[model samples]
Target: MPAQALATLNPETEEQDRRASVINELEEDESVDEVEHSTQRGAPNTGTTPANAAAQPDIGILPSGQTQPSAPDTPVAANVDLNDVVTAPESELLAMQLDTLPMPRPAQPLALLGSEVLPGTSARLAWSPGIQIPGLSQPTPVLAVNGIHAGPTLCLTGAVHGDELNGIEIVRRTIYDLNAEELSGRVIGVPIVNLPGFQQGSRYLPDRRDLNRHFPGSPDGSLADRIAHSLFENVIRHCDMLVDIHTGSLKRTNLPQLRADMNNPDVATFTQGFDRMAVVHSSGSPGMLRSAAVAAGIVAVTLEAGESHRIQEHQIEAGVNSLTSLMEKQGMTSRMFVWGDPEPVYYDSDWIRAQHGGILFSEVDLGAHVSEGEILGYVADPITNAQYPIRANSNGRVIGMAVDQVVMAGFAAYHIGTEAEIPAE
Candidate 1:
């Protein structure tokens, strides 16, 4: 199926504002893994904010070759920093400030990919009359065109958890701006895939089912199970690739990054095509959509972005740019975004759990660096007010840390990066 013609530009100021206002702080966030960037800002990402997928297919998606930058140039933070200038009541803060930012134009799909090598069969296809959600409903799905020109069917999903809504915004932007004229393959986008959870502003579904844990579900099971089952059989099985987008849980944040099966070259290639974004290896869950896709012989990966329950511009851009980056990699589109060099750090991240239940104090922010045996934070008894320090077990970076001060003994404190084969900078 051919991608429909490009829609006329209808930039949503509010949406764009949402991303811009938050991007600066997020970009400079010390916790995230840094990537060298040529442009002023990084890329965009997928689905709704509520909460959180798939498969194994053959001939994993691999890039023919990677385009290397002249040098790994880490652009310094602008001298006129947005963080220093923008001042507002915390409640009235904006998402991103991208008015002065440059953009990557939509490349002629055929010209960018070289039509000679693109799939000629016109395997483009799309689903029909997608159901709509209740709250925050604008730019209805009917007005949207989710098309795939050729090659394979890929699904970009996000906001399975309500608070994790960055992916949802990313998907929305993709649909609003998709120019079908240059598409080479099928792309299915599920922005705010978990509408019920998203509307409730919670991670779990309205019925309290963890959507990620209920995949390949049963029609006769819980509501989440049925939906999961339907998605698996009806939607997931049809795709050649799957990318799930996410953010850190409430008050938590992640740098723009990807998690996929490193052993599978295809999956690795797809993950790497997301230029300027860190790639982390993961063992997809048995019930996960990534695992489901893997099992179905489809190559899939999880694209993680900034913190949860809040929208950030850089992350949304990161999500969008990553997909487009893959489009460039797959020769599906012509537009090539000039991006930054990524500081790709590999780690088997581990959680630093609170040793004893109490009110807690955290010193470092998410994306901060740490050394082995370093103190992550401290826990204090509420009644007794006894403080105990929690320390790291190994040297690595802090990808995420608890935002709330109150803590429980089992609650995770610091999500620390650990031993992995990080590509040298």
Candidate 2:
């Protein structure tokens, strides 16, 4: 019988059994034991099932006789103190809906990156710092489209690493495709933030410092810091929500997914706006733009598409479609977007590393599901003509991985995504 039809036979008992069954499956699986000892934050922790996760609460599956907190009453942008909520027991996160903003964002002009964009219009602005890099006379580009009606300001920033070409294209296609008159909220797109690195075709700033690590920057700090400060204050501060687009760094590639801090009710809810995209639970590292934005009360999430430096059309198309669906969900667009089945939200992830340095080749493609102990790839020594098979430690899906190339010992190779029970308080 269909589960839904069976669910009606004994609703209460069925629900309790369902929750218990999920926990039992996780605890009973031998692979789950291996996952508990593995590294954190690679793809997602492997093992367990989310068979009924879509029907469960966003925070987590609930136990019998327990009720979640009611959704917040105010709009997400009212600057609510989320510290208490985020710190609350995991159960409360299931019901908090912080993105419930009042409709029609109060039709107003948006002044961003030094340009005044009126309602129902679009403009191209420039973002330049007070202390510019040598020979960087040209300012960075910022695209804005102010909707005819009022709504939230949704910001899309790309190319923060300079060589992440896929992000630049994603931002361009998303913004240009939107019609200003049909939009509800303002859409701000910055196609390139690290122009210096872009010009040099490198991932770091001219000083070799990573621009991504200096978020919510200081004007009196290093070159990267100053530029981060300008962008954050001038461009980012005006946003009600932010999606900092990115691709895999170095030679790694990611299945189209979102890295989000699920503890934050606002961020958790905001992630639901995307359609058919996997959600990987991550608090985000310090100094990351997504982390900094969340700290500033903005609902934010990082969208990871493909590998860096290359513009893959399939990745670009997936990103654009997801963004379009998000805008539709957020009421920024009048268009209809039919959403697909909810993608699994991996609560835990870990990266499996190579044991030996050699020319590596993957057996499983990105997004492939692998059983525990399955061979993921082989690391073959070019000089000795010997090969070593790299295997998965737990059952999971490949969410991120290194491209076929020479690898070093301890190189992160495959990222595994798994669903697991959030421990009881």
Clashes of each: 75, 9
Name the top lDDT candidate: 2
Task: Summarize candidate 2's per-residue lDDT along 138-186 as a digit string, tens digits.
Answer: 8888899999898889999998998899999999999999898888989
Q: What is the C-alpha lDDT of each candidate?
A: 0.64, 0.84
Give the per-residue lDDT of model 1 (tens digit) for 1-425: 11121111123464345445546545675743443232223222322221110011111122333332322343555568555755565534432444445543332222111122132312223322123353633321211232334444567777767678788888777655556555656566677667667777889877787788777777788877776786677566756788888888756677677877877767765666677776666877777777777877888888888877777897788788877777777765677577667546555878788879887788776667788878878888978979999998888877667775777778887877764654321
Model 1, residue 411: what's the lDDT? 84
Among the numbered candidates, top TM-score falls to 2
| C-alpha lDDT of residue 197 in model 2 | 90
Residue 406 error for model 1, in Å? 0.9
List CA RMSD, all candidates.
Answer: 28.7, 22.0
Q: Which portions of model 2 show Cα errors greater than 4 Å? A: 1-106, 133-136, 420-425
